[model samples]
Target: MFSTSNTLLYADKLTDFNMPMPHIYACHLSDQLIQFTGPDKKSYLHGQITQDVNLLTNDALLWAGQCDAKGKLWSILRLFNFQDDYFAITSKDEIENALAEFKKYAVFAKVDIEQNKNHQLVGLFGDDLSAVLSELEIILPTENNSTIDFKFGKAIKLDNNRLILCIDKKAQLPSCITLLESEQKWQSLSILAGEPKLNNQAIAEYVPQMVNLQAIGGISFKKGCYKGQETVARMKFLGKNKRAMYILEANTNKPFEATEVEQQLGENWRRAGKLIQTSFDIDTNRAYALAIMPNDLALDTLLRTKQENPISIEIKPLPYSLIEE
Candidate 1:
């Protein structure tokens, strides 16, 4: 079990981002929308995604990944049933193209795939979420419960304290709240939580274990086969996976592209892993980064960037335990 260190609090500057603040984080799945309906909807998705769709009782949230034929993950999706339709939310950049890929194979299947760009999905995350919901008098559904009754799209409890409120962009939310103006604080929270955003730069670069997916209940090994099942299972059972995701906090303002190799040690660049998400808090003079690296490197090891101007980076232990031995 990983606990927040006092060093983290001392090293990073505290922000005025208080509880009940309405912070907006973009859900990239809007770009890669797959609307699965008709008689074969459940069976169709079960075969495509990494998780078992039958496990979701129409009211629960299903976290799954879409992998290429080679078993590399192209998209991570959060699937949920909204009445008669099944929505597969994936990365914005890959979703549009992923939908087309699915459509081509789904010629005989009755399922229909389309991108829902007009409807924007935002994640309202905070630790004191219960208090926020109590103030709004809208009790967000639990992870197992679907939000179809609330009519605010759907809500899922991502963690012990974090609550995800999914709402349609065009639809008006009854809750009285204003958007908080701090992107830095939100990014910090995500890093501390070890949650990586689904983006083009990081997509298809690592398997589920590389991003701590199995530790977070994203992968269901016991469930039967799905896309890339052979590779995922083989790696897990045979101890072939060597890399895992880690949250690194650094003291730098320079921008780094995700998945780009930052050369260190010598001329040869170690393509061990890729950067997931990062943000700089100008007030704190610090930046936060989520990167996936080889397990042998050892997590929480402090190091310096190999850029023209090197920066100090301290890797923090992720909240979840790695699946690799």
Candidate 2:
């Protein structure tokens, strides 16, 4: 059985169970929340992120990106509106750097940007989520990108089977809720779901389009100017984006790390792209990763690692079509 005390420690032992139900799993995300309070919060964010902050409703969540002047992404954010105050979640490791960048423009705005450590991010996956929530008399939003208030915290519906619970650090969950502490399992599900989460290593590396942010409703070309508006707009209108995100699977003796992934042309390997994130299942010896690579590459193209004994990678289809609308 999996215990919350040590989540990843028992991952390899999952196969020993007779038939594991689609257990409700939880993991504390390496995601940090930034609180933006003051009358100018919404207006200030509108000019900084890729998504239109003005369109964010109290019941809906927005997945947005903060990019550099050149259109390269600084960090991907999940913005929430609570009680007239706006809160956004970004990579915990990169929050300090993101805050510094925001400070440059916030000087003129009348908003306060500060990290809120009072809350913790918990990710829940599996078909049992709805039933589990129902037992607590907590109802989740039926629509994707929508949110509802729960007793333990705020639940953001990612899909019918997945949710992201932003809980208060002091609140305790019911004993009926089973927690899965393994970051690997949580990450594997995210990669397989075609969700792109940026980390410290990925900051200021690629633009939103390279990671298919536009396809996931993370970018709004119709919105007013933001930091990278021109660059992002040109790529969308002029068809200038040459790279896109793709999912790949491979077998590794250990686990796959976030490194530069390469592609084979003939006998030589060239730099194809960099990995955004990766997950591994030790029981199956299967590793999954999300990588940004040239969009024009042939479907039969083969990918490998930069190591001397390169591990072969197989291409996998994304959950949604990549066609830009």
Candidate 3:
């Protein structure tokens, strides 16, 4: 069920066949992986993300953003050091577009931007991840706050809600596979992580804060202005007013289309928000979805899908702080 080429590497690790299935998948990027070199490298990225790049040790993984002049997040990233080179991984949805955008700005900068889909990324999840790794005698990365180049398995908190064991695809290890979580679990977990994806439905609908990007270390207030900085800063200091994304859980059998309207709001069946991702509990058959809703909406807001088995949903608190400032 897995394929490898001369340019690729693959390994499987022990995992529980029962609890939260482990999934191994590559992080495909349309935008080339930009390797920044030279003395100006740190300053360049420090100007980009929410966290101070200068503060990041070689082993630190920083959560950052590439935003528009108005501060709308064009892309989200996690950057770390790899030897003398610095690597950044962004979302697949915006990779190509982001790459094109960066090329225009690169101008005379000393950076090498090349599509590095050649370097596959394999991830392991579940409460048993550490146990399985130990069984294989693999030395997992230490849980140090410092930034270190990772060679094999290392558990990092993607956010407050989920922990991930990240492995470089090119590394050799015991049999380890990526167990793709069901659509519902994946979405629910993502929402809990407070990490938002730029899907077709959520592509340009909201700004960075609407998805709580800055609150999760995705934006840097001290950094020089990149694209969309003004808007993001204004919203943070002034207020978001009435717009923000919310996560809710409800029950229904109706089929739901993310970003599409499925319920009546007022005058007509207006668009409330988009169903960004979803996963179902294999045992309960209950679907949990992640969605973007108006900030004023209630947690128990009623929602229905258009399918014959209309799906129901409920709002839940994201496992992060959503501060006004």
Pairs of residues clashing in candidate 2: none
Q: Per lDDT, what order, best first?
A: 2, 1, 3
For residues 199-298, write the lDDT of model 2, one tens digit per residue: 6688888889888899888998888888988888888899999999888888777677548788887898899988878888776677888888898877
Model 3, runs deviating above 4 Å: 1-39, 135-150, 153-173, 176-188, 250-255, 261-269, 279-284, 306-309
Against the unseen true structure, what C-alpha lDDT does each candidate score? 0.61, 0.78, 0.54
Write the candidate numbers in order of decreasing TM-score: 2, 1, 3
Q: Is candidate 1 or candidate 2 better by lDDT?
A: 2
Off by over 4 Å in 1: 1-33, 130-137, 141-148, 174-176, 181-187, 254-272
- Model 3 residue 206 lDDT score: 65
User: Roughly what TM-score does model 3 have, to 2 decimal places?
Assistant: 0.75
Clash counts for the predictions, in order: 2, 0, 49
Per-candidate Cα RMSD to the true structure, in Å, reads 7.0, 3.1, 5.6
- If scored against the real structure, what TM-score would every candidate get? 0.79, 0.91, 0.75
Where is model 3 poorest over a 10-residue stretch in terms of lDDT? 7-16
Query: With candidate 2 superimposed using the best TM-score fit, by how many Å does residue 37's alpha carbon deviate from the native?
Result: 0.8
Compare the candidates by TM-score and give the number of the best one.
2
